[model samples]
Target: MSAAATTSQPRRPRSGNRRDEAARLAVLHAADDLLVEHGFGALTVEAIARRAGVAKQTIYRWWPSKVEILLDTLIEDSAKRIPVPADEPTAESVRGYLRGFARFLTRDPAGKVLLALLAEAQHDPDTARSLHERCLAPRRARERAMLTGATDAGEIAPTLGPDATMDALLGPIVYRALTGASIPRGLVDTLVDALLRPRAN
Candidate 1:
C-alpha cells in the first residue's frame, strides 16, 4: 500500500455538516477500538455510537454504515504509516514503502481491521466494492505511477509491467501477513534487488 506523506494528525470528517471535530474523532476512534476488541462480525453502528458517547444518528449523518467508518479509519491510518518518499530513487522508495507496509501489517491495529474487512468483502459485494474503490484503488494507482516512472527511466526492466511488478513486490509480504508468518529481515531488500534489477547499459 503506497501513500503520500501525511502527518499523524487526525483528519476531519468529510461527509457531514457537523463541524465538531471532537465528536468525529471519537466516533472514528471508537469504531476502530470496537472492531479490534470485538471483531468485525460483532461490530455495529450502535456499539460504535455507544462507545463514542454520540447518538446513532450522528454516526449515520457522518457515515452510512460501519464499513464506511472502518474504511475512513483505514485510509487515515495508512496515509500516516505507509508514505512514499518523494526525494528518493525508485528502488529506495519502493524499499521504504515495503518496509512500512510490512510493519503496518504486523504491528498496526488498522492492519488487523483490514484483514477483517477483506474477509467480510468476500461474502458481501458492497464491502468488496467499497474496499476496492476507497482503499485499494488509490494506493494501487500511486504504486503503479512510481513503478511506471522507474520503467520509463530505464531503472527497471522494460519487460516487467507495473501491475506485475507490484504483485511481485507486495505479494509475498501480503501472503505472510495473511498466514500469520513472520516476515524475515532483509526481505524488502531482497525483493527490491531482485525485482528492480537495473536495465543493462
Candidate 2:
C-alpha cells in the first residue's frame, strides 16, 4: 500500500470515538459533582458510573481509577479558569496571575477537587505522586515561570527564590481551603505584597 494509504488506515476504536468521548465527559462531570457533594472517601466508581449513566465497565475502559478521572477534570477546569497572562511587566503579570489562581481556588470546582485529591494523597503515596505529576507539576511550572520573570526583572528578592515565594503565596490559600476559611477581601493583594516585599539592603 502507498504510504498515505497505510498512514490513513482505519483508526481503531479509542477514547476519542464520539460515543466514548461523550461517556468520558459524562464520567468526568459526574466525578466532579460527586467529589463536591460527597467528598473523596465516599466517591466510588459505581457511584460515578450510575451518575454518568454509563456502564461501570465504560469508565474502567477509559480510566483505571477514580483518582485519574478526577485528575483529568481538575486539569481541564484549571486550564480553563487560569489562563496564562498576557505580555506585560513582570510585577503586574505576576500579580494578575496569582490573583486569578486565588480566584480559581475559591470560585471553581477544580479547587475543591484539588483539595480532596491532596487530602487523599496524604494517606496514599501513589496518589500523591500521581497528583503531583498530573496536576501540580504543570501548574507549578507556570508559577515558576512567573517567579522567574519577576526575579529577572528584579521584582523578587534573590534570597526568596521561586519555590519559597510560591509557598508563601499559596500557604495561606491552602490553609484556608483546608480549614474552610473564607478568602478574605483583598487577600490576593496582601499575598502579592508579601511575596514582593522589599528586602533590607
1-201 per-residue lDDT for model 2 (tens digits) = 564553343222243459866877888899999988998989999999999999987677667789988998988888888865534447767777777777777778878898888888999998899999978887887777777766777766545777788888888878787788887758878877766866486
Which lDDT value does model 2 have at 114? 87
- Models 1 onward score TM values of 0.84, 0.86
How many clashing residue pairs appear in each of the predictions shown? 0, 0
Count: clashes, candidate 2: 0
Specify the highest-TM-score model's number: 2
On lDDT, the leading prediction is 1
Error of 2 at 142 (Å): 1.6
lDDT of model 1, residue 69: 89
Report clash pairs, candidate 1: none
lDDT, model 2, position 49: 97
Q: What is the C-alpha RMSD of each candidate to the true structure, in Å?
A: 7.0, 4.7
The regions of model 2 sitting more than 4 angstroms off are 1-15, 84-89, 154-158, 199-201
